[model samples]
Target: MRAPTPVSASLDDLEPGDQALVAEVSPPHELSAWTAWLTSLGFEPGEPVRLLSRARPGGDPLCVRVGGSTYALRRAEAACIRVWREVARR
Candidate 1:
């Protein structure tokens, strides 16, 4: 079987309306406060998520949807979460 091509990227790299799957979330330090916050909001590997919107003035806050819930995350917070782009098959 072919290995999946790496499309992993931080949330800051995402554009609005992009659908993605949670890939790997590496906190600045393992088992830290950052990890707890992310996991609580369903930022886990294999989770279906999408970038909803970006705040005005700057993309400091990003709205995302995971499962049936939505969240607003800061650029710094979202940067710690890595995700894989979900490309549609033709």
Candidate 2:
């Protein structure tokens, strides 16, 4: 059987209304608090995180949905997250 195509993407690259699986999460810098904080928010590998909305004009704070909860995250914070699975063309 053919294996599923492996794809990688940064969370911030996702357009509005996109959904992806959290493949990895890295902090902005070594020993950054984001590493621990993200984990607490269930931002772990294989977790389903969907981009719900973004701030107008410039996308800064993003609205994301994880599992059943939604979170408002900064663009920089989202950039630290990597996602897998090829997003279907919209």
Candidate 3:
């Protein structure tokens, strides 16, 4: 089977109902903030996340539903939000 395609971007780029796992963080320095915020929402480094909605139009906050909870994150805080295509799961 083929591996999933990776899309690297900030969390704000994700669309509603989109699902993906946290891949790598760019620069690595922002790991602490990312870890803390994600951990609070039950999103571990390798856990899957489902995009629920964007906080506001053209805003940096992205509202994502992960592990039955919703999380709002700033785009800059999550600098390297990588996601895989759901089709690759099949």
Candidate 4:
């Protein structure tokens, strides 16, 4: 049988204190410019990332830590980064 595909989640989908690995930084075609900026901010594949916190009310600005630096990103911007959550082994 074929192996099951791994479930991927967007960075915006993670809750505060949650950790995940960067899988991709692909913004939609309309926002192609975001790709370079996001990568320059250290949101590269295989880099470890964590969700620090989110603003109250609308939660538009999400605080995330990637590499040694932290950045604040919009919910829509965060959605561009795809991540793979680690599953705990039994």
lDDT of 2: 0.84
Please give each candidate's TM-score: 0.83, 0.84, 0.61, 0.88
Off by over 4 Å in 4: 1-6, 88-90
Clashes of 1: 0
lDDT of each: 0.84, 0.84, 0.62, 0.93
Q: Candidate 2: where is the Cα deviation over 4 Å?
A: 1-4, 88-90
Which parts of model 3 are misplaced by more than 4 Å?
1-10, 25-33, 87-90
Using TM-score as the measure, which candidate wins? 4
lDDT (10s digit) by residue, model 2, range 1-90: 455565789888888887789998886676489878987898999998889999987988999888888999998889988987563343
Candidate 4, 1-90: lDDT as tens digits: 454345589999999998999999989999999999999999999999999999998987999999999999999999999999865443
Pairs clashing in candidate 4?
none
Candidate 4 minimal-lDDT segment of 10 residues: 1-10
What RMSD does each model have against the real structure? Answer: 3.8, 3.3, 4.1, 3.8
The most accurate candidate by lDDT is 4
At residue 57, candidate 1 shows an lDDT of 80
